[model samples]
Target: MHATPAPPALDLPAIQALAAADMAAVDALIRRRLASDVVLVNQVAEHLVAAGGKRLRPMLLLLAARALGHRGPDAHQLAAVVEFIHTATLLHDDVVDESDLRRGRKTANALFGNAASVLVGDFLYSRSFQLMVELDRLPVMRILADTTNAIAEGEVLQLLHVRNPDTDEPAYLKVIERKTAVLFAAATRLGALLAGAGEATQQRLHDYGLALGYAFQIADDVLDYSADEAALGKHLGDDLAEGKATLPLIHAMLHSDAATRDRLRAIVEAGEVEAMPEVLAAIEATGGLAYSRRRADDYADAAERALDGLDDNNAVAALRGLARYAVRRDR
Candidate 1:
């Protein structure tokens, strides 16, 4: 049997060209900071780091800072800090969801066991705080500290919503807003803050990141249903398998008739894919995927709008490209 070909890379030439040097510095900082004397910690951290992701969050911070004419070295430290926080969450998230795959590779929890993954995740969190302290900027620390706390709350809220077929679009959006977008907002705003940008500019960047996060996450959820497993770099139906009623299911439930909705609820509650074909069919019939994508596009539009008053530069253009890519990416 032949191996399936990997999907084409996500288009990010503009972001790449603009952020290449900063990203390299971020990567170097990541490698330097992730080092641990403990064998298990080093092993687990290295494994996940090597697994490789687009590092988009840190890239956003770097771009936002440069776009605002920030020339400080502190931005680099903060960018690495944001990436560490993101990786820590992925570690814990996989453990909580019992996820076995991510980014087309075995998840840390899957490869290293839940105990190791969780502990290493804790290590990353602590290390990130240590980096935060290095900056000695109270406001930046406060934003990250509050953002992390909100993310925890979002995780708990999502836990409550699991297997709950009645989870509404508003409830789901709130969860993503806290769990994901808050951090994105912090990342972008921190850049503006580092540059000593005025309150208005900082707020605009914050709004841009917040809207971009929503678009990015909603598009991600849609991919769970609409993308091929190889292209998605994870199993299709993973969300359904975990019994999470994300926006696709939420929209499908609302649009479905009583009988179809009842069936969908059963699948959600049972957390099984035995009825996946039927559930997907119902979602397709009711235009769930289309609805979700439309919602994502709306957020992307909001992100672009947030950039309207920013001075024109390559970094600003890259930010716009990133907003477009948020909704358009295949993985």
Candidate 2:
């Protein structure tokens, strides 16, 4: 009879609240995990950790656990473990992407070089494994192991898709699922798992994570077309320059007439994003960016749907809000 309250705006206050909720335990775990015999381990770990990461993966874990009425300490430890996995991926990603700037700071690979970044990513991965073993959770271990493997596979898949403008939705989804979705799924699943949620609830958490991850990544691709360099922390149309056939580009090429399509192909194949204005105009004309945003909205809707059975609470509502924020964020 009455409408349920929508989640609050993901403004600074809310983001800060989420950060505060996650800060203490994840920070401690990072410090504990970064310790090593080699000095470069400490240096590389500190550089990336101190480089002002958003820590979204950990926030999702902690909040999802809180949403499910979990107050136990294990959630925090697992949340930190999720972040370590994410950070490791990021370090490796910078090297693979061969770019500079993350969150407005010089990329770890750019500052420290590829070898340091790659080796430190290995350190982070090993540290995460050690922490998971400490948790003594077979399910958790299985989830992460599968997730990291999926990520690695996704990276290669994306590289394969690069410079090829024919990448369609299915191809794009496969790349994002491995490169992004599994980690999100694993993090939220860990929360539900730690909460001792029923099988149904655990599945819902996985669904939410998967959908949210798709929304998050599709939005990022849209940002590459629309975002300003200063705010987005990367060059506009970087995906195009890198020959990444994300949804917008893939969709545009799929729908374009042969001449227009050829022009688009040349842009991607050329590997010169200096023509971003032209690319942006073409994508906008074909409504590719709008189409991408709409698909992201679809995934966000699915994410909210997965929360249908969660107990009525602010945290639950916040989780729904997060689904929207993933698509709506400008930066």
Candidate 3:
């Protein structure tokens, strides 16, 4: 019986530095392909791109490719394709969520209206497919096409759960698996595919991405309850206002007394933003945040374990750091 060795210390800046060159290329490609003759399309697409998120998904692709010994222009094109697909989803997501802010800036839908945002999102999607066609790889095309379909299914699945207090952990996990984890899997798997890695290695990378996505989304749910609004880049109770029954709230409800459970249910069902104080109190009392954090830690550990057989290198090290950072990030 041997204990699993601990992962190395997480250094996010170091990880970013390692991927900095590749990411710059991806960014440039994204900007170049984002241009459209229609002024509104350009405005909406540029708005989201300029907001400047961590670009973690495409970075995952680049890092995975490097870990598998690939340094080619094809990775850059595919990385940009991943970004465009991700950005398109975000655009549509804001419209569906009716969100006003993202990354501390007004959402595209907020600035340009839902119609413009949706149409531009379509443009990005089509552009991504065009880039994929240029790559001339059927496998790449299949993976992304399937991933986008799964994301659409995830959106509808989440819509069904929204404002429904009956949503449980299993159902929530299903939503995240499709909405988030599948794309993460696609990104890393594509990395492996591009590098001509074996089936086993590709499977490992896919598993790593899947687990990381779970950890990241779970940690994000916890942050919605406990993180500073400024650092979180959104209102504290945005999930609650969206009537989303995320892990913390679900956990709190499961462990609370009938009265408290009913209160939580009402809050979720009614999108009761004002009930955040009470919800936080219940979560604290029930150790819901602690429970959710523990779940995130488990998934992060799985992500690290999935990388065990990969050759040790700067890229692999960064992947490990990313897994830890997924659960530990402030925003």
Candidate 4:
């Protein structure tokens, strides 16, 4: 008897190819909706959209919608809305972090000035709300409203933890849930809602998005220390310079000797860029990076498991591929 054929490998290109047409539509919608009468707002918003990253969040919404057999224009509109919300967060985050660089280029706050960036971020947030209101779906409006509020709370929570070396893993996870995972969960859950999916299916997709968000952010924190500056598309040690005690640093502190722990804590409190070499050595010696990678992989696995009972389709396969990519990507 012939052996059972293996399932096809769904690499990044394959996944992107599968979602290309839908993404193109989403992009078009985004551009049209981003237009404003104010030129500065237009310039800043255009600059941000042009310096594009992977567009993963919107793609997640699109893929989830397609997975549930949704082919309507509502998916496109909602995807654009998700992109606007995410873009707004980035603008605000750069200002809050005092970051000069993102995606290997000057941040909007750096180029357009902080006030412009902040105001334009508000524009995007308000624009996104407008788009959602146009949808006239109460559930969609409610989910996004709650998600944005949680994100704001997360910013405050992270601000509190900044420069506090005592910030532990649980505290960090709470920040990640609000700042990153809530939006992700909103995207997928909205897709399911638009598709008229059952409540159980919606919850599973929400679980998938949340796990993927955790995996993505944890891996990003790892990359901030381990990846080359070009590959990472931002300054190495930015997190250190921001005084944010991410998982690696927390793990290193937990596992290291008293003297080393004290040194790490002191460096974090000071936001000392000059102490990076010492910090790297401590992280390596304590297996901090490895431990963090293991945690990211666990979350990725959880993301995949959340899709266990879903229909086997290209979109579902792409979702699985994204979970794998979330942990494996360099940037």
- Candidate 2 TM-score, true structure as reference: 0.95
Candidate 2 off by > 4 Å:
1-12
Clashing pairs in 3: none
* Model 3 agreement with the true structure over 1-331: per-residue lDDT tens digits: 9965544644899988989999999898889988888988887777777799999999999999999999778999999998888888899998999999888899998888999988988998999999999999998999999999999999999999999999999999999999898889899999999999999999999999999999999999999898988998988888899999999999988999999999888888899999889999999999999999999999999998999988778888889999999999899
Q: What is the lDDT, from 0 to 100, of the residue 324 in candidate 2?
A: 83
Total backbone collisions, model 2? 0
lDDT of 3: 0.91
**Cα TM-score per model:** 0.96, 0.95, 0.97, 0.97
CA lDDT for candidate 2: 0.84
Q: Each model's number of backbone clashes?
A: 0, 0, 0, 0
Rank the models by lDDT, top first: 4, 3, 1, 2
* Model 3 regions lying over 4 Å from their true place: 1-10
lDDT of 1 by residue, 1-331 (tens): 9954422222488579768888888898999999988999999988988899999999989989998988556888999999999999999999999999999999998888999999999999999999999999999999999999999999999999999999999999999998899999999999999999999999999999999999999999999898988889998999999999989889899999999889898999999877889878988998999999999999999998898878777788888888889988889
TM-score of 3: 0.97
What is the per-residue lDDT of model 4 for residues 1-331, given as tens digits with 9 covering 90 to 100? 9954434437899999999999999998888999999999999978988898899999999899888999668999999999999999999999999999999889999999999999999999999999999999999999999999999999999999999999999999999999999888899998889989999999999999999999999999999999989978899999999999999999999999999999999999999989999999999999999999999999999998898888778888899999999999999
Q: In model 3, how large is the Cα lDDT of residue 87?
A: 87
The C-alpha local distance difference test score for the whole of candidate 1 amounts to 0.91
How many clashes (backbone atoms < 3 Å, residues ≥3 apart in a chain or on different chains) does model 1 have?
0
By summed lDDT, the worst window of 10 consecutive residues in model 4 runs over 3-12
